[model samples]
Target chain A: MQTLSFQFSAGQPAQGRALVGCVGSGDLEVMLEPGTSGTLAIEVVTSVNGSDARWQQLFQRMFSEQQMPALNISIHDFGATPGVVRLRLEQAMEALADD
Target chain B: MNDRLDQTRQQHYQAHDLLWGFAPEHLPLNAPAWVVEALQVEPPVVVRRAQGTAGTIAVGVRGKTRDQRFACWMPRSAVSHSVQPEQLIEPGLAQAHRDWPLFKALALLAEPLDQSGLRWGVTGSLGFQLASGIEVIHPASDLDLLLRTPQPISREQAKAWLELIAQAPARVDVQLQCPAGAVALAEWATSRSQVLLKTQVEPLLVDDPWAVEHVAP
Candidate 1:
């Protein structure tokens, strides 16, 4: 059960689609697209299946912690741990923050 | 033993000071001060008056047998000896060792992407203070790695690397994420892999977007 989620807010769409990448064996890729929706959404795809419950717990924890606004978040997970997921999620937020 | 402990403690303090010096305000919230002290260690080395090698110490880890211990050292006393602390002995070193398997694993499995084009910088434990805070010498913890790859990362590569490292050793944990894409990746993975992988991962924001640094008045 290795999943992550987050969101951000912006007055308008970002300059470009925020892209999060990985290549460290076992990990998946990520692409975040902004939408007309006021709130941002997050998605994750991982190789390790059958742990949605755990993913929900982790996502809920992070979402409440960050209190982010509106944005679409996406993830491709191979088998990453909570820590790696955390870092990657943070990286994505930071990339969006830059926008 | 006391001297060894003191030296180890000094190394610990040195790492702490260095980390603070680099990023004073922004510290790893969960990481404790003692944890850093525990992992900061001196490679086993003892300088001898008799040897008179300009006070350069002979460092070596002890072994089950004296013969085995001696074998780990250089053939010649002055031939430059380096001691590798056992995994259990130090937390920081242990983390480095723990990460070795996965780092190497990624190197072996990853589709060859020429990093030469990328403005790649492998910074962190490998630098000075020589501490990654993953050793058992004091309080052991997880491994931390920062990879600022050349170009922006692709979604496919991110998930692949994450899964690969996570499957390495159960007790050990590995994280490979872009400094910028952490948050977005978290959101994206939620819907796609929400069932298993995404649930376990937690991503966040890095690179200090605020630029907290400023000049003194």
Candidate 2:
């Protein structure tokens, strides 16, 4: 598995934690938890190895585009397509927002 | 013989007898032969559904490629054993209550369903992790559930149940198992014209849950 971490300084910390999706075939799960630090941290563990650059680019694009708060977002991936990953991330964030 | 077998058709089996297998179509490994070899080396795939016939039963297998699910007929004689989902989950939940805070929380959240008289079982990563002692669950794993009900669930009732689960720390995916078939609570909540119902025979997009039936091959 490949692990990647990122930090963003866009939005304020979310009120609570939330999660979405399951780590199954062509799918990925995302978890957003309250972060003690002021930074928004994202850590992705994926089965697809040697695609660090591609993943980094994707994460950069997502974080840059979205107004995510200061929370720790962790993803467990099982070779999910980019579309699925993005949907899960958005759902997780939406859940967190609702919380 | 048909009557006796019909009685056993949809009956749930104990977890010890069941051997989880991967679907031939989705087997990720390049070598299909290796999977066949592994099946010989591993336990024989057990029957998931007893179709009340001489040759076959609906067998459960996971997709190798994507998270697609597969349940199809296989010769009953080929199965070495059967497994119960409830048996695998209850022990794990009990153990987790003593140690894991997250699981403890989930247990508490699930209490209402038990009180509601719904037969429920956990099935996703948490279930797999607890049953196999595998490290599948992370800090953020969703509490996937299977709820068995003898009768159809109303849309309003489904929403109410979902509201109860939404209070949990993690997201919950509940599949309501009615006599006709099992449908995801989330999908059912949409109140769509048709919902995907997974039955012992096969999955179908059915509007009326009661009218759906699984015919043995």
Candidate 3:
């Protein structure tokens, strides 16, 4: 297993914490909590090693296009495909909005 | 099909069929070393639901480890023998494996499955062992099953099926092969929003897997 962290500039902290997806089902599980007012942080625990660059690129590609609230995100990844990772992140963010 | 003259019509090979006589030479030139070495044993490849070229069928070669699977296409003509998952579990075909937790789960599922009358079949390690007698199943092996669903079943029906499957001694995973793709039976039963539909090319989280058109990404 490998753990990687990333930080991004962000808007105000999200109003509430939220969790989405399930780790045991071969999908990425994501948990989001309000973070420092101006920073977004993500910690990923992945079963696949040597995927640091992919995660970096994925997060950069995602965050560059849209602005998001400052939140601490914890991801438990079970070798999920990039699509699954993206979907779970979106799902977690949406769950936070629904909270 | 009786009046059909199209010779190139693709032959139907469902997911989980064990196909024999696939030549290693047909594999891509840059195939992984492990894939080439695994084929040296001449194991029957398992048919996958992925789409392939007109004359080829998508198949996966299994190696020793969980990460050793390699997907490739094999010409239809290269398939000399085919055994469907249901065929492997025919009453007299399987050697007695009752002591195995996997088999115990299958035994527990038999009566309800038969009574339900859904077109279901075995798959995964247990099916592999039964088909080839390779004994790949371990003590902790989960019983994997495929439920063929040309017509979408109600969520209530899927929930019922899940409850029945949950009674097994071991964990069970059931995939519902809808007309378009496959979805986990558990997700279809339980998910409040969209469920993940596994198509040949990609997985799409869709509200209805049985829909006619998918917004392919």
Candidate 4:
């Protein structure tokens, strides 16, 4: 298991908690919960080992591009492809936005 | 009266029967150990299938407090009544099965289990999407299945099932249901000792389902 943690600046606080995706082959599970601080904290647990740098780069790019709110996101990945990971992250943010 | 009894006998329960009995709080202290244990996780609503005895039905109990799911058996006599899974499945999954190729393929693969007296249902993100009408399934999402079987399966049988399921176009996670409870077939086949099983109350690291009883602390 590979664990990576990062924090990013966000605009506002999210109201509710939402969970998206499942940790399966070529997929991952993302859980978005309201955070205490004003920043977005992301922690990822992936089956793909030795990809910490790639994960960090992907998350940093996503945070910089998306106007996300203050939330705590936890991802459990089961060898998800980059495209699938991006999609799940977007869906998790969308779910938080809907709330 | 004989005809009425015959009609009732001929009416076998199908997959995804939602059975309701006395609430957990209302069950007597002396109720069957399994029933009491199962009620502690989910409510009395049991998802029925054709996997148990004639008078008993299989139910899938999912824990709201934890990431656990259990396959249990309950006596039909105790259940006040039951309903179909269609009533529980939201419209999203039905619509997706028609429009999405992956879900459509999953439906096709699952279609044969019922005929073999083994019932199958989705339980992971796809199941959540079906229940909540949410778009939780991604292009690479796996098809996690909760399989109900009439009896305990041997390691060889479990391995055969897994090999068969792995042939699907997408990744497939199959949880084999036994008389006592359910455990991932992969774990059951591979683990030499202490296989982790999702029981009605909590997750237990036991040698086998037969050893899973009163696991809660």
Candidate 5:
């Protein structure tokens, strides 16, 4: 029962190059759409089944460093490692489109 | 149940039976002693107290508030119970067992949804136990429910849920009045529309499609 949510606003994209990305072993999915809401909503539900504090720390740091807009992101993890989560989140953020 | 009670408690049980009569379903098998303890107080100021002697008390309060109204019979033979402390019916607590079958239906129908972050609460008139200019014209009258959820619901799903609730077996009868069905939920979503009253039989839906607003900010 762990949840991670964050909001971000990335400036308009000049061209389409998959605003978000996906990074997982044998299972990766990303949703890219025009941003209507000012802030992007990111939700991640993972089955990594570990300490909640670690998840939150990694998620917050990733979100703060990236600071991308025009995207809402989510990730469902099944034992996906930190490197994998970071990769998937970046892909998702990049795939997003500007409205 | 009566066969197990002591003589004194038995007399009290008989007294209650004489006053409230018998409802096998409604009778609390183990009447929470707290209810009796609470009743010993001013018993939450009632909204509409019964007028005549021995009239069953029907009090109304809001779900968010603690105010309780008691509708009880006051016969000349016995003195009204004195108030007690440690049990204060704060304002806004709604109780509606005496007037409408809606509350009864809610009590019977509500079951927690799994892992959906959805919770159901009763607000407005039924939740408040006050008439929102609505009348209970039938013994099978339906009451309104406030459905708070994280995911968007399709019109088909909403209707199906209503049908499920209507078909459930219980002490009270229920009829569902979904505003989305009347006006078309998809069409409403396209226009960013909120629910509006169409007629006496219909209820409205407001801000239901979006996930952000669905969950509390």
Candidate 6:
């Protein structure tokens, strides 16, 4: 498995933790926890290699403009496509927003 | 030509079916090294679902590991041999590797699965191996199954099947084949609202997969 790290600038820290998705074929599991002030840290452990740039592009597309709360996100990915990754990320963001 | 495959008159290929006789030099110009090598190894490429193009069908090449799968399009006319999960069911049970978790689980579930009366069979790694004798299954490889459920099954029925599947030595992933598309048995049994429906074009989140009308492209 390959582990990728990405950090994004953010707003205030989130209050509660949220988990979404699963480590299944063509899917992923994302866990969200409140992190240090003004920084969103993400670690992705993925089964697919040579996907660092794809993840980078996806994250940029997702979080480029929107300022989400500071959270530490850990994703356990099992060869999910970018579409699936985006879907799970959106779900995680929604869950965090609900809390 | 021993290609008496049980397919529709339209020759609609479903995901996870294995197809042979593709031109290896037919990949996109920028195809990766591993993909080229894997195709040269001459394994039957697994059929994949994607938006339909005029003459090309979507397929994936398995490169010995879960991480080594590559999705690409193949010319439909290039398919010399095709094998579906239905045809592999017998061979999967007849294979002598019951000591392996995947085969063992298949053996354990065969009777009950037959009794359930669901048009079910093997797919994924185990099915690939059984069909081609290429040895794609490992000890931890999941037993992927497809239950052709044109009629929507009750959540209770899905739960019951889940319980039965849980008894197997291997992890079983059963995709319920609705008229529209497919959904995971675990999700359909447990989800309160929408579940993911994997269609040929894309995955759709629908309350009832069977209720959705499949639109052919």
lDDT of 2 by residue, A17-65 (tens): 8766653334566888887556888898887766677777788888887
DockQ class, candidate 5: incorrect
Give the top-scoring candidate (TM-score): 6
**Tens digits of per-residue lDDT for model 6, B1-217:** 1232322322478777788976677688887788888777678988886753666678888887777887888888888989889887884345566688878788888888788787887888888888888877777889889888988799999999889888899998888888777788888888654577777767666778888887465
Per-candidate TM-scores read 0.32, 0.52, 0.80, 0.42, 0.24, 0.90
**What's model 6's lDDT at A48?**
86
Model 2: CAPRI class = incorrect
* Cα lDDT, model 2, residue A40: 83
Q: In candidate 6, what are the lDDT values of residues A1-99, reduced to their tens digit?
A: 889999999999988977766435777788999999999999999888778898989898889878888999999997777877777777777777776
After superposing candidate 5, which stretches have Cα over 4 Å from the reference?
Answer: A1-3, A9-28, A93-99, B1-217
Model 4 lDDT per residue over A28-96, tens place: 778999875578888998766667888888888877777678888999987655665777677767666
The top-ranked prediction according to lDDT is 6
Positional deviation of A22 in candidate 2, in angstroms? 13
Estimate, for each residue in B1-217, the C-alpha lDDT of model 4 and write its tens digit.
Answer: 7655533552455444455663555444555455556565434444533245455566655433222344556666777765443333333445644545456547556645555566566665566456544455777666767677646778887777667666667777776665545566776776544454444334444566755543322
Better model by lDDT: candidate 1 vs candidate 2: 2
Q: Could you list the iRMS of every candidate? A: 12.9, 7.8, 3.1, 13.0, 21.1, 1.7
TM-score of 4: 0.42
lDDT of 4 at B83: 48
Native-contact recovery for every candidate?
A: 0.30, 0.00, 0.05, 0.05, 0.00, 0.30
Using Cα atoms, each model's DockQ against the true complex is: 0.14, 0.04, 0.29, 0.04, 0.01, 0.48
What is the fnat of candidate 4?
0.05
- List residue ranges in candidate 1 displaced over 4 A: A1-15, A26-28, B1-217
What's the TM for model 5? 0.24
Compose the digit string of candidate 2's lDDT tens values, residues B42-140: 423334433434445555443232223334455544444545445545644445434454475566666687688867776655655555553546666
Q: Record all residue pairs in model 4 with backbone atoms less than 3 Å apart, i.e. clashing.
A: none
Taking the tens digit of each residue's C-alpha lDDT, what string does model 5 give over B1-217?
3333332232231111112121222224554433444433222222221122222332222112111222333322232331211111122333434444654455455553223244444332343233221232344534434344334567566555656655544232211123222222223333222322111112223344342221110
